[model samples]
Target chain A: MTFDWQYIVDALPHYKTALWLTVKLATIGIILAIIVGMVCSIIQYFKVKVLSQIVQVYLEVARNTPLLIQLFFLYYGLPKIGITLSGELCGIIGLTFLGGSYMAEAFRAGMEAVTKSQIETGKAIGLSNLQLMRYVIIPQAFSYSVPGFGANCIFLLKETSVFSGIAILELTNTTKNLMGIFYKTNEALLMLVIGYLIILLPLTLFLTWLERRVRHAEFGN
Target chain B: MLNSGISVLFEGVNMQRLLLGLLVTLRVALIAVVISIVMGILIGIIRTSKNKLVQIPFRLYLELFRIIPILVWLFVIYYVIPANFDLNLSAEVVALIVFSLWGTAEMSDIVRGSIISLPKHQAESSKALGLSVAQMYRYVLIPQATKRSIPPMINLITRMIKTTALLTMIGVVEVIKVGQQIIEVNNLDHPTISFWIYGFVFLLYFVICFPLSRFSRRLERKWAT
Candidate 1:
């Protein structure tokens, strides 16, 4: 089958809508992940009481199971317990939950990697715990974890495709839809791959740049 | 009691279907794991080679696979390839190819990273001793790298099993799909059954993957020290 541009052109409006939905979903998911991740990682780093153990369990469960199963649980299982969520909302929850677990690990690593003396010096200066974290700990930790966060973002973008299973008409779902309408998998699939490449390719490049910059800054390169 | 999802799961036919579906998932994961290991090593070698020509294409292959989601790759393997050629394969077999394609690229990068991260002195010393390229890798480089590769490889295996869930999306009737089928067949009669059945699927995946994930973490800690 020859490559078909006409179908791609015809499907652009729908595809554009789908692309925007995907970007919106992923952005929201990533932002939520950053919040959840920061809290979980800080708890672990500080060795907080029962809360840290709870965070550990959450990380294990979230990391081990497939995103598909998590989506199924939120989309199908939650309704049984007297809660209901739209498919897009379920998608966001699953993405954030999984992405958060991974991000928490990054933040934990970054937090621990900060020089012990730096923290001690902040305390010597009479900085309160919260102030220390705000001025010193979080800034360095986040910068050190820049590459980790970038990887999580790329993973999140791909994970958004699975949201299609829950009836979210994101990019992958849009491709499936276009294929059904046009009866040509070639065109739809091609456009889908290119669409992903367009976003992911550049994202990967920028992430590498950020990673290098972070490492350089850290090492005084 | 007899109307519950557990009761439905205990029905002989349903039990057999779920078990069979689990087997399919395991089969896919095992085959993909083996293919990824062997193919990944070869790609890793090329990736670390001094030749730019060899490096660029493999790097592209690696990145392309990395960027695309496994499900999208599965769709392309299952639908687009068959349409382009005179090839007709079972959906399950197509699923395996997709997993291997995804896994090989992933595993290769892991291997390449470990190799490149090694001190250059090891290879230089081996060269000074007149060790052949093959001999150097077989004895010195690979032996050290393999240890580093294991924790990541285990992580990759867990990921492999997890992605098998996506096969359900492509009509493979894997474990998750079987659970969905049961839910669909029972939804009208037993509204609560979907919850139990799907929850069981989640548990099954946890049982299969969690141990592997734990082991990988343990390995990571041990290796770090």
Candidate 2:
């Protein structure tokens, strides 16, 4: 059970590929999630007819369920209905499905934080409905939502770990595969944790800085 | 076709097994939640101490849990520690330990947030009324903070429940694992059995979590007014 560095060195190339795949999947998933979130939030904000109820149901189901089961349903269950998704596609879709609802909640909270007086001010100034939303609501909402968006980004990235369950060769899967091959559980896992720290720590620090920047700009600190 | 897919749950002892597995999930989550709440309160109170030594370590602990995925923590505790320390623990034990550790970090943050968010005048008035420090906290702060923290804590409980699904990865016989077992046995006859089984597992979680989340939201709304 003594520590071994050579196993990590041996597994470095596989780790590299796995890291790339994880990054690629997470990036595409997050972009799509933001798009989904924006549309859902807009529907909710405007109280669009039937779509708001559909979004509510979508949010509840997505938020309550774990990504692993969702992946199982998508990867294993969907084939029963004649829809087959590749492992990578399943990973992306599951991530987007999960993340979109969370992002929608964040965006909705942001929109809700906009004051009624601000909207009235915009209306009183002869701004049309579209112009009011464009000029008054969106910017303030985006600024207020920065912290929530940052947290969701981190959450979505961490969730990509479950993509391994669907057979994607991501970081966790690569670590387990190496452990099985080399019997170097300690080294492989150490690298796995460190690899994630390497990826996440900088983003966290940057987000904290960005959050502070937004806060100061908002409050005149 | 729909009848055949639905028949998997009615098979021999399958429904019972899934319920037993679900009980195990709730058991693990409940135990972890209780332990985390008690320990988190203590840690949260300690964290408010103005000592850099105490605060720095707790900050590190929180960030460690926040930055890393729980799955990795599961593997580390389940595999690495037992091998290194010559200690053998069951999968359930490992799951409990990892989840409590994660939950404590989260709960402590919640506690810390609520404590700090109290108005400065509340503390000032309590002190001005000749209340001792302990008396002030016990009588004035703790009660208010606990009430403020309940909604978020309930939300955390729902999160912990959902997170227990990760236990299946470590081979814990939780609900999802039970669902997988059912699918394995029935896939030959009903190739669509997974859709039904996983769908049920999904609903099982939603049924448990939705009400809890709704309650939390209700409390949040009530308290806001």
Candidate 3:
């Protein structure tokens, strides 16, 4: 029952792949969420009829539901409809859809934070709505959202661990597999905790720094 | 809109089975929330304290809980504790511990935020009125903080309820786990049954969570104005 390093040493290589897969899942998932978020927020911002209502419903359903159920629905339920996806693929998609909803809220807040005065001035200067959005509104709105984007990315990283529930062999899954073989559940889990801590601790720190830097740059501090 | 799933709930499945699973989830979440609020308030008070030693441990706790996903926490609590310490705990008990631990950390943050956001003069006036520190907190501070805290607290409720779904991963036989079991037992290699059963699970969660979330949002908007 004592903590043993031997099991971890023996299992390190497999764990590395799991860690990499976790990273890849989170990276691709956040990227897709950002894309989804930007599009949805833009549509909602313009008060686009019908589409805005759809966006509202999508955001609410996603925000309310647990991500594990969403993953199960995609992983287990979707195949019922004649579509089969690998666990990793389904997990990444689930994370993308879940994180996309939160990311949309952030972007919407950022866009609304752009004062009416700024838009009016842009319009007053003979800028077309298209030119204004491209040159002024979107850039400023994005800068306002850098902090939100950072938070959303960190959240997406955490959410990717849910992939293990669907058997994606991520860090937690790798640990469980090692435990199955080595019968060193505690040691294996300690190593897994450390692995995630190592990855996430520095990430939280870096996001904090990045947020500060973004805020300073925005305020010209 | 989701009534279609309700028929699947009772059509080929034991209604009591799903309800029992759902009861387990609700029982765990309810107990965990009560524990969290109590522990959270105490920790929140310490978090605002002047002593560094008092604050550092809670700070570490918060940071650790923030990164470690609930699924990992559930696994570690359910499996790691028993294996390491030679203590046997049931699934529901372990789930309760993990959820309460995580919830306390989060709720404390909420408490700290609400209290800190109060005007400096409010606390000052309480002190100037000859109120002791306890009185200042109990009579003057908690009321205002509670009002400001309602929105975030509601958000945490929805989060706590949703997190109970992760209990399925650890084999808790909670609602989602029950849904999975039903799908497996009923379908017998027919995937389409899962479409209805899992769809019901989704709608069940949506029904429980949507109203709370909208209420939280409304509170947020109301307070913002």
How do the residues B178-222 of candidate 2 rate in per-residue lDDT, one tens digit apiece? 888888888889888999998899889889999999999999999
Clashing pairs in 3: none
lDDT per residue for candidate 1 within A36-145, as digits (tens), equals: 99999998877899999999999988988989989998899778766899999999999999999999988988888888888999999999999999998998898888
Off by over 4 Å in 2: A216-221
Winner by DockQ = 2
Score candidate 1 by lDDT: 0.88
DockQ scores for all the models shown? 0.71, 0.81, 0.68
TM-score of chain B of each: 0.94, 0.97, 0.92
Model 3 spans > 4 angstroms off: A219-221, B1-8
| Pick by DockQ: 1 or 2, better one | 2
Give TM-scores for every candidate, taking all chains together and pairing residue i with residue i.
0.96, 0.97, 0.95
Rank order by DockQ, top first? 2, 1, 3
DockQ of 1: 0.71
Taking the tens digit of each residue's C-alpha lDDT, what string does model 1 give over B126-202? 99999999999999999899888889999989988988999988899789888888889987777777777877888
How good is the docking of model 2, by CAPRI class?
A: high
Which stretch of 10 consecutive residues in model 2 chain A shows the poorest summed lDDT?
A212-221
Q: What's the residue-level lDDT of A117 in candidate 2?
A: 85
Across A1-221, the per-residue lDDT of candidate 3 in tens digits comes to 67677767877888888888988889999999999999999988888999999999999899988898898889887787778999988988899889999999889888888888889988999999789889878888888998899888878888877777787999988887787887888877888888788788888899888877777655322
